[model samples]
Target chain A: MEILNLEGTEDTPKIILDKKNGIFEISGRSLPEDSAEFYRPVLEWIEKYSSDSNPSTEFVFKLEYFNTASSKLILDVLSALEDIKGMKILWYFHEDDEDMEEAGQEFSELVEIPFEFKTY
Target chain B: MNFIYDLHRTMMSQKLILVFQGDFTQESTKSILSMAERNLDSSGEESSIKRKVFNVMVEALQNIVKHSDELVDGQVRSHAAIFLIGKEANRYSIMTGNPIRKENVVKLKGALDRINGLDKDGLKDLYKEIIKNTTISDKGGAGLGFVDMARKSGEKLEFEFPEMNEEYCFFCLKVNVPRDNE
Candidate 1:
């Protein structure tokens, strides 16, 4: 499968999904008006990636801000990865951003994926 | 008109940092967020406070864009809503107003009241429960906006629903983020 790379906009996040090079990260702002539409291809890509085998998959999410709508889509993204073996998530938050940290904690609780929270 | 100057005086007197009253689109909402962001940046507020204010603003503006009822009455256009930010001595208050169908008032009020009734932990639990059980609606809402706003502000959400007409009511919501420890 081809890489699903997207440039970040003012209201959307940058997405990089590469299974061959072992790069899977979603970063920056994520407050898109139509979050489901923006993330549709992402979910599709993840579903396809799950079928192929990887020794271990580490996904990174370094979001600066995301609205409530994006939160639901984000949960969907995490839940989609629940079935993958040897999958882990790295969630990053700013030191001063309790809300972002709490958001990561909440997502971790709602999904079976192992999440390691990191601060910058 | 003199009323224009009068309105300006009122805004100045109230210490309004920003005020927008017009039709809301996704594009317009993005612009509004960026403009408010710049204002907050230049205000020299702490990053934590700014983040809370910005988060609440995103939820408030997007709610208007998604759920505001169309006013078919004369002069009022569809998707029309109002957003205002006021800088007080120790807090920043974000306010929004939009038309909603009269029929939805009771349900919306119940949601807000329930949120207000919860403590911090209760709000957190409610947020988690809703996110776990609810699917994203076609409108892209998971019924989490009010709870998220309340959680971030660490304060009660203030609101009013004034009758706009026989069929609609203007829903007004206000959330305040403290600038200094109280």
Candidate 2:
């Protein structure tokens, strides 16, 4: 299986998708200028990963900040995992970051994936 | 000569903390966010309020980059825009202005008016509906920025479209985020 790892930048998030070690995570600021273009490969990878099997997948979204355009792309990322049966999401937010917490709650409500929110 | 001092007096009178006027690009947007983040951090702003302001700032700045008239007369204009942040006793006001095609003004105005008319629940529903249905444009816009800004700031978006010329107009938007949580 091919692993995907992208370093976080000043405006974009770091993404890691490794089935071998069972680590699927996206973290940091996500205000990329071209969000759709930025997330295309990530979506494609997730699509391919869905075809193959994993007993269980734990995806983490520990985003500190994301623009509205990135919000739609994030939703697309979640939707791409709809076919995976044993999918769980771990969302992390800062202690006083109500907006991030609410963002997690909203996403949990939108998708079928179960989410466990962690406060840092 | 004295115009610089006059401009400073005006900024001070308005309680303006930061102002940027130039062609807004992705690089400039990143710089603006970083500078504003530092300003808020130094002011001892609460985490929640700072996040709201930051979110609104991103949307406002990106809005300029995505919608402004970068092309005019088959030539690429500068995408010149202005951004301002004013610190007040009760709230932080974010304002942005950019040139837009005159023909597109009506549609943009209608969208803003609809957003202003909605309450909290209404805005939330609109946001959810858009995210569920709309496709991100090639320019990476989902038309969700204004709605997100309204929801985050918990205030009606103030706007205007003053005529700049026959084919273009100046689009201005202002959003105020309360300093203290209500």
Q: Per-residue alpha-carbon lDDT of model 2 for A10-76, expressed as tens digits?
A: 9999999998899999999999999999999899999889988599999999999999999999999
- What is model 2's interface RMSD? 0.7
Q: How would you encode candidate 1's per-residue C-alpha lDDT over A1-120 as one tens digit per residue?
A: 789999998899999999999999999999897889999999999999999948899999999999988999999999999999999999999998888998999999999989999998
For chain B alone, what TM-score does every candidate structure achieve against the true structure? 0.94, 0.95
Writing each residue's lDDT as its tens digit, candidate 1 over B1-182 gives 99999999999999898999887888888888889889988878789998999999999988888877456676666446899999998999999999888988999999999999999999999999998888888787878999999998999999999998798888999999989843
Task: In angstroms, give how far residue A107 of model 1 lies from its true place.
Answer: 0.9
Q: What are the per-residue Cα lDDT tens digits for candidate 2 across B44-79?
A: 998889999999999999988876645566543654
Top candidate when judged by DockQ against the true structure? 2
- Candidate 2 lDDT for residue A95: 83
lDDT of model 1, residue A69? 84
Candidate 2 segments exceeding 4 Å error: B71-76
